[model samples]
Target: MALFGLFRRKPHERQGFELYGAAVRAARHPLFFARYGVADTLDGRFDLIGLQVALLIRRLHRDPDPRGAALAQAVFDAMFADMDFNLREMGVGDMSIAKRVKNMWEAFHGRARAYEAPLEARDEAALAAALARNVWRGAVAEDAPAPRALAALAMATDDALAGQGLDALLRGQVTFPAPRDMP
Candidate 1:
């Protein structure tokens, strides 16, 4: 019987968070990694994602202009909830890729807001170029659960994004390089 099938209680069936936790458990397989290159490290990626999203949620609650925060939260939620889809989309094979993606997002949010109000023509191309260095893909060795660099980078990104408004960040209108260019 599957591990999930062994659970007699249907707590997860009733609670969305519990269901999500079960999904997280299933995402740990190496076959999962082989099919979806990102999200190889369960704890680190989720922790950083949870932290960042918490901040986004709080910001959305506080912001008078909350559309950006809401959208960012939604995007993050979609990414985290579908571990396989996100990993496959990003072509990530280890934790470092997670970190790189997080850092890139944060850096874009952190420094991309020097443009005109309402973010018209915010020069995303330039901003993306600036953050291009933060991208990482498949840098972890086969034996490693996740790359140390990814953990560090994701933590750093979380710190950066915690204080910011997503709309202001997105309004700044920065473009991210294609995923393949991520280091």
Candidate 2:
């Protein structure tokens, strides 16, 4: 073996990856597009996954245990790692992939922060406005009810996650409320 391995690194924390997968699957539920009118385009899909991931990360941050912080970091690392791999698979050039991923990270960060205040205050109207702008790119009106429906689902999701124990999440389990069950 050569003195320097090409890319020796610690194995990813499986728990984070599994959790992210759950978030992705939840984001892909058909009702989001069929009923709520979220666009079925790439950007729409990305925003959906980012929203779900943000909610999970929000819940992760609430745990007082030291592991919560570490777990949250792992989730973020896993998400970007997967994004990098996906970009490479899609034939994005090495130079361009970094820039693209950076842009996505920034978008995700901004979207997460935008939801934080409204989510905290249970402001459905504000949450609908943010979702309408981000998920629909402002194509849908804030009072149109589609975004408000998503806001209701989001609120239910936040409540569902809040009810789950930290121990279950640490063990790589998360539960998002079923969209159909939401008003």
Candidate 3:
């Protein structure tokens, strides 16, 4: 069972931005990616997950319309890659931790709409909350990487949307500087 399995308590529904922010915060720990040297550089892999979360929020926040299932599959694949690299290369010296990560990956992959609407939102909120509760309490093993990869996957989808210029759709109104009259 996953560490949070013991609780068996469900969390309340939340806004997409709130969910994304929480996920980012949950995965923003240096000790996590720092372990395997995958994050040894100054690029700050520690915030990679958080960035991913932001990207996802930016996308979904911009576009309320549903995306094709293929997009979700691609995201799952990318997340699988990141999770593997993070655990195998940058994670602390712990096999169980790796197993847990693998379990999460499998579970996430097995899901159909990992990035779809209501289901996607549900997953993000649950993972973020669980990560926050665990990482804050140090419930996971030492040097054990946090489960930010999930959030990263969610964010990756947002990146695709942004690439398609869909960010403004969800971001709402923007104030651009007008040209000076003295031009």
Number of the top TM-score candidate: 2
lDDT tens string, model 1, 1-183? 688788664322223333233324432334324432444464434533343333333334445665544444544454444654566576777756667667645643443232112123333343223223222222444223333323333334334444654444444321111111123
Off by over 4 Å in 1: 1-40, 66-69, 81-167, 172-183
Model 2 misplacement above 4 A: 1-12, 181-183
TM-score of candidate 1 against the unseen true structure: 0.28
Off by over 4 Å in 3: 1-68, 90-100, 106-132, 138-183
Among all windows of 10 consecutive residues in model 2, the one with the lowest summed lDDT is 3-12
Give the Cα error of residue 79 in candidate 3, in Å: 1.5
Q: By TM-score, is 2 or 3 better?
A: 2
Residue 118 miss distance in model 3 (angstroms):
11
Query: In model 1, what are the clashing residue pairs, if there are any?
Result: 37-92, 38-92, 96-150, 124-174, 124-175, 135-183, 136-183
RMSD (Cα, Å) for all candidates, in order, is 15.0, 2.7, 16.0
Give the best candidate by lDDT: 2
lDDT by residue for model 2 (43-76), tens: 8899999999999999889888778777888788
lDDT of 3 by residue, 103-128 (tens): 76554433322334423464655554
